[model samples]
Target: MSLARRHREYIQSLTAASAPAMDGGLAPAAAFDAAAGHAPSPAGTISTAAHTINLRLQHDLRRLKEIRSVANKIAVKQELIGEYDAWVAGLLEAGRTAPRGTLAPTGADEVLPTIMVWAIDTGDWRYALALAGHVLRHDVALPARYQRDAATLIVEEVAEAALRAQAANNAFPLDVLEQVEALVDGVDMHDEVRAKLLKAIGTELARGVDAADAGDARRLASAAIDRLTAAQTLHDRVGVKTQIKGLEKALAALPAPEPTDPNTTAAPPQT
Candidate 1:
C-alpha cells in the first residue's frame, strides 16, 4: 500500500480501539449517553490524536532544519573546491607557456622601485624583495637544455642579485637566503663551476655582513651559517668533494662578528 494510505489505516485502528463502549442493544445516541459521563467521545479522542500527530510533525520540521544546515555547508565546500580546481588549471597553463625555467612575472617591479625611493616604506621593501627573489629563482630552474657550467653561473648570478637587493632595502633576508641556498644545493656543477659558485656565495655573505642592519644582522649571520652547513652536507651526500672544499673555505673566510651583550648597566646611582 501507499505510505500515506497505510498511515491513515493505522490512525483509524487506534481511533477504533479508543472509542467508548456501547450499552446492551443501545442506539448511537444511547451509546453516547452511556459514555458521556465517564469516557471521552469520539470527537474529543480524535482531536487529542490529531494534536499528537501535529507535535510529531513539528519535531520532524525541526530535524529538517538541521539537515538543511548541513547540506548548505556541503554545497559551499563543493563550490570552493570547484574554484580551486579552476585556479590550478590556470596556473598550469601559464607555466606551460612561460619562458623556459622562468615563472610568472610580478606586477610589483615599478611599485618596488617607487617604494624603495621612499625611505619610510619599510613594510613594502621586505615583501617586494622576497617576491622578486622567488620569481628569479624559478627562472634559474627552467627546463631548457643547457650546459651545467652555464646553468650554474646563471643561478649564482640571480642569487647574488637577489641577496644584494634584500641587503639594499634592509629587507628580512630569510627568503632570499633560502632561495640562494637552494640554488647552491641543487646546481650540478663541475669542479671549476662549483668553485666559481662558492666564490660568488662568499662574496654575497661578505656583503650581507658588511651591509646588514642591526635588526637583521643576527638573522642573516644565522642563515649564512645554515646555508654553509647545508652546502657541505649536500656535497658529501652527492660525493662531490671538489665543491665541498670551496664551500668549507668560504665558510672559514666569513668574519665572526662579536656577540652583542643583552644586559649592560651604564648608570650608577649616588647616595
Candidate 2:
C-alpha cells in the first residue's frame, strides 16, 4: 500500500481503536456508581470532606491499577497498541463517573503519553495517536501547564520520527504531525522548542537540494516552503527566519517540474 494511504488509515484507526469494548463489562462512572448504589459522601467540614476525597481517590486509583495490570499482561502477550487503546477507552469512561469537580490528575496521566510512543517505535502509529489524544484530554483537566508542555515534547519527537521514516522510505509520520498541530492549537511553545522543530524539518527537507534532480528538488522545495511558511506563523525566531529566506530563494531557482510519462513528451504543433 502507498505510504499516504497507510497514514490515512492509521489516523482513522484511532477512532475505531478508541471505541469502547462491546462486552458490556464495566459501565461508565456515573452508571457504575448508580448501579452499584454507591453515593459519594456529602460535602461537610473541611477535614471530613478532605478525608472523603482521599478515600474516593484511593478507590479510583485501585480501579486504574486493575486495568493497568491487565494492559501490561496484554502487552506481554499481544500488541501494546491494542492494550493501550482499550486502556484509554476505559480511562475516559471512568472519568465520566467521577462526581462533578472531583476529577483530578491520576497516575494514568504520566503513563498515557509515555507508553504510546513506545508503541509507535514498535510500529503501531495508530494506537500511539489514539493514546496521545487520550492523554491530551486528561491534560486539559489539569492546572499544570507543564503536562501540556510534555505532551508537545512527545509530539515533536514523533514529528522527528516521521521525518526520519520519510527519509528512509518507510512510513510517514503524518499522524504524529497532525498530533503536533493539534497539541499546539492554542498553546504557545517556548521559542527554543518552536525553533528546534522547524529547524529539524527544514534541514531534513533541504538535505538533498544540492544533488537532487528537478523533480526531487521541486518536491523538497515545496515541503521546505510549507514548513518555513508555518515557522513564520509560529514565531519570529531568528534561526527560523534564516531558514525561511534560504528555502524561498532555493525554491524560486528550482526548475519547472519534469513530465512523468515517457510517451507524452513535449511536442510542437504540426502545421
Best by lDDT: 2
> Residue by residue across 22-88, what tens digits does model 1's lDDT show?
2231112212222223233343233232334345434533544465565563443333323222222
TM-score of each: 0.25, 0.45
Question: Candidate 2's C-alpha lDDT?
Answer: 0.50
Give the poorly placed runs of model 2, Cα more than 4 Å off: 1-85, 92-111, 120-123, 140-148, 162-175, 200-223, 229-249, 255-271
**lDDT by candidate, in order shown:** 0.38, 0.50
Off by over 4 Å in 1: 1-153, 159-177, 183-187, 208-271
> Clash number for every model?
1, 2
